[model samples]
Target: MMRKVFSIIIFVFMLSIISTAYAKKVNKEINVVISVDKNRVEIGNHIRLTVGVEGAFDTDIPELSVPESFSLMYGPSVSTQTTIINNVVKVFRGFMYGFSPSENGKFEIGPVTLKYKGKRYTSNSINIEVVERTPFESTIDEGTDRSGKRVDINKMVFVELVTDKAEAYIYEEIIQSFKLYFQKGLPIDDLDYVAASTKSFLAEKLGDERRYEEVRDGILYNVIELRTALFPLVSGKIEIPPAKFKCNIIIRQQRNRGSMFEEFMGGGGRRYPVERSTEPVKLLIKQLPEVDKPEDFAGAVGKYTMDVLAKPAKVKIGDPITLSINIRGEGNIQTIGEPLLAPDGMNNFKDYDYETKVTITDRGDGIRGEKLFHKVIEPQSEDVDFIPGISFSYFDPDIETYKTLTHEPVPIEIEHSDIETPIRLSLESAGLAKGKVKILTKDILPLMTDLYSFKNQGVAIYKRPVLLSIIFLIPILIVVACVYVQRQRALLSNDVGYARKKHAMAHAQKHLSNARGLLQLDNPPEFYATLAGTILKHIADKLNVTSASVTSDNIYDILEKRGVSNEVIKGLRQCLESCDYGRFSSGQLSREQMESTLETAEKVIVQLEKQL
Candidate 1:
């Protein structure tokens, strides 16, 4: 009995030693391990930091804290999980912290400490790199990204605006992607943009949020890419406005290096503003050539095949038939309009129209998708026997011209029914027939003319041969003028350079109008560059030359051979010289001087047009 009592005292003493503040060794040991999804992250992205406290203890769960650089968003969401294996019990207390780094460069998030049962334990430090952008992205940051809220220099995320093509023909399919690239794990409060208006290009999202890891400049960054496709509405230079986004990101305020406990236990991280944007992009969209445009081409672009289906091939008069017209292709399926179901030029079918329901499925390589149209139509008259095949025309971007596809007519056999369907005839609200009725009327002959009441005013000068010849000649002249117009249209439609020459003046004028808005620049470089571009483009279009080949030396030769006045040639030289000089010089120039330069460009083009 004395030995049993002595064993109990020893057991109690051991327990007391294990719980001491300066215990040499802890039998109920908990080794905290720090882990993250990634070692590198962006400011807007988040990382999951788990402080895993693993031990064979029955109790004594440790508390954890991260470094000062990371904004701990959620948790220390504590989970004290226990499991048994091989008759041995294990306990794991995971303290997970969702944090976003607010600073850039390398940060050591460690020596996180946990305190339990009067003892303190420290975890191994984790090294992480936080950057404004991916290592692969070298795009410089702009001031436009700053919002009203404070920004952490270490934590920066931004959006990227990219277009697949620098130039596109009118109605050509072009992809515009807006990617909100942030660090992985960063929580986005709300991300949104105003829906693009119908007056510009059509915009469609390519896919949902995509997450991946990319290494840029040797730094690994977690990324989320959002994609969109833009189809320009009109020709000329269309500006896709910059995408705007508003967000809130946690900021790990500056604090001491020792314990993470002070921040979480005292006053934790604050939420800061993270607003950023990509610069607006300008797309040079040229007009589709009218010369080779098919008369049937309805401005559809891409490669496509068409077919029409009707539920019931045969129907009685007034019975409805469900028709499905499908167009499947690679390219802008959304731009395809309704098919002309009555292409046989027969009035047999009524105008049945509907919106094209497009299913844009992006096959791993590119957009190979389909569009469907469903409509219900009834036979207007018993005489109509078959639904004529319809024609759909689209410009094949691959072939650089319009191609028409025809869906073969659907045959419908009519069944003649002797049933006399009652038709109701109603008068105005004041006089209406209650029951169905038919009205019958007989034709009446015209009354005799009263010739005695009319008197001749004159001999009728219009009856003379000369006046009659002039009057009769007018319509013939009009017919000839129409023929000439048709021929001109045909030529313009067929020749690309000829079309460019025709609209070159108008195009140059449009560019000048844009430069007019730029005249407010306090500097001279942009104004001169724009002014020079307008003149060069005009000359290229007029002379059927590429802009790159339209140097002043070559331009002089062209103008001189075309017999432009030396004075006009000199003015052209002066304009080019002024642009080059203003582009380089930091010299002060008045707004009036820039306006004068603009005038010189316009006047030079007008004179050259008349001369050459």
Candidate 2:
């Protein structure tokens, strides 16, 4: 017994020593690392710095105070790495910071300090030489990328205003498109545009569309396009001001310094930070010349001819007439303003209907198109009307002058000329009626014609018995029902299972509808999301389980116990997987796959309903 007591004391003492040693080691392990690619900086330029903490037990790095000469352009984004080897765990935390020098000078970037485990650690001071940017200066390339290529990062992000026609007349329309191009391997979050030319230009974002890909030059780029319809407010040189935009470009970093480990560990690097668009761009806009301008010019800028085509040159009064105004043009057809028509020829027309059709295709020099305007008119009068010749004026930019084209007049021969029957007027004067012509309102004495109407205006009163009877009977019936015994047990008891089935079927149809719409749009992500959400909600409702508790495992167990077929269960799992992948991962499903998934979901829901 004494020897056992001694052994226990020795073991306890050993444990205490081991714990003390660990405590000391933790107290001394505080680290801060600062690194940069260059010792120099410049105005409107950025330099990257990486701060790391090597060994801190349950402690975070202290907040850093940046110098006045440097501006913190971006993070301080943090990342952590953990390793377990031989049953020993080690965690390393890293923070990346970007600094842009405010002006050209010699700047000191720290003595950045960190306190951990009751100890303070300071990084080595770094002196950066900031130089003024020359007229032709380039930013740091950050070395050749993984593809051994460098892109002009400055040019990758810029705003450009492109006009289809630089010179357009005062009332003419110019198609202006704004485009943004990102460099290879660059991903941007969103774009915010400011500083428009006010009411002078009608600017609008054409479509919420974007595309990203690696170009032939080994640069990954994202391109966005915005369009606007610009009509010059004035006639002279109109300058389109620079449009400023703020774009968030994803900044990426290497995980383990090189490619071999990244490819092997599936680390594949990560987007560790972000950079924003830096500058705005300007465009020189010129207005069309007023020389030789036509007095009746309709602000057209292309070569065009006008033609009036009528369905029927001669028709009845009620017949419909389709008068097509065809303006075949070669330039700025899509930007044509609202067309106006003179209504003098269309008088008495009940309804005036018009439609515009534009077709574009590759023709000769570039893309060109023709637009046709069709107007349907219905005349209400019987008189024959004439559609006089219409004149269309357009600026012929090729010849540096304006020209007016006239459509030939069209005459309509109305077959219903006799629809208005003429009244006959008889001239049988000097008859016996001429001597008897007298005024009737001259207050003559009442004759035999007025003897029957003695008094036609007299007030009379009569009481109706129907309204009084209803008013007395409704309340007497209420008093009679107060003494009657209500049938308390006749109502059917609520069937919980039937209610569940009813709700399940209703919700299932809702899910099916959502999936159908998503499928029609060919959106795989939304299709799968709606499809999976609908099925899961229906199952939860049918099984009497709360939606929050409907995990994949829980759902599978419930469905299997409910005698759901293996095939249907398998399809449910497939749908869930597809949704998970398309939503959380980079897997994209084809249109056929989306349609199949939608159909399969419906079948599975129907089968589940059968089992229930």
The number of the candidate with the highest lDDT is 1
Give the CA lDDT, 0 to 100, for residue 567 in model 1. 99
Per-candidate TM equals 0.40, 0.40
- At residue 5, give the lDDT of candidate 1: 100
- On a 0 to 1 TM-score scale, where does candidate 2 land against the true structure? 0.40
Ten-residue stretch with the least lDDT total in model 1: 439-448
lDDT of 1 by residue, 1-612 (tens): 999999999999988975572332323466777777567677766777777777733344444545577787787677666543333446777767788778788887777777766677787777778887453333223222232223333334666777888888877777766666555444333344442333587655565446676544332356656565666778898887777766655344454333343232222344456667678878898887787676677778778899788879788877778888899987777668777765553565565567568887783334668999988877767787677777888887656777889876777877786766444333332124334344221111123256577767876766688988988999999999999999889878687578888888899889988778778644467678888888877877887754534654356787788788999999998998788778756587788888899899889988876775
Query: Which 10 residues in a row give candidate 2 its minimum summed lDDT?
Result: 485-494
Tens digits of lDDT, candidate 2, 1-612:
999999999999999998786656544456676666445545766777777676654556546666787878888778766443333445578888788777787767677888764567887666677787543233334443442222234645555556677565554556666656665334443335554453665443233233444232222345665565554556666666655566444334443364532333222333222234323323334566677775666567767767678888777777788878777766656655434555566565654656888765423333256778777766677675666556677876566677877765677766665554333222343243344453332234444467767764644222546767787898998876764423222221245444555678887897789778767766666667677788887887787643433545346777887888888889888877766666444566678777776777788888888886
**Count of backbone clashes for each model?**
17, 3
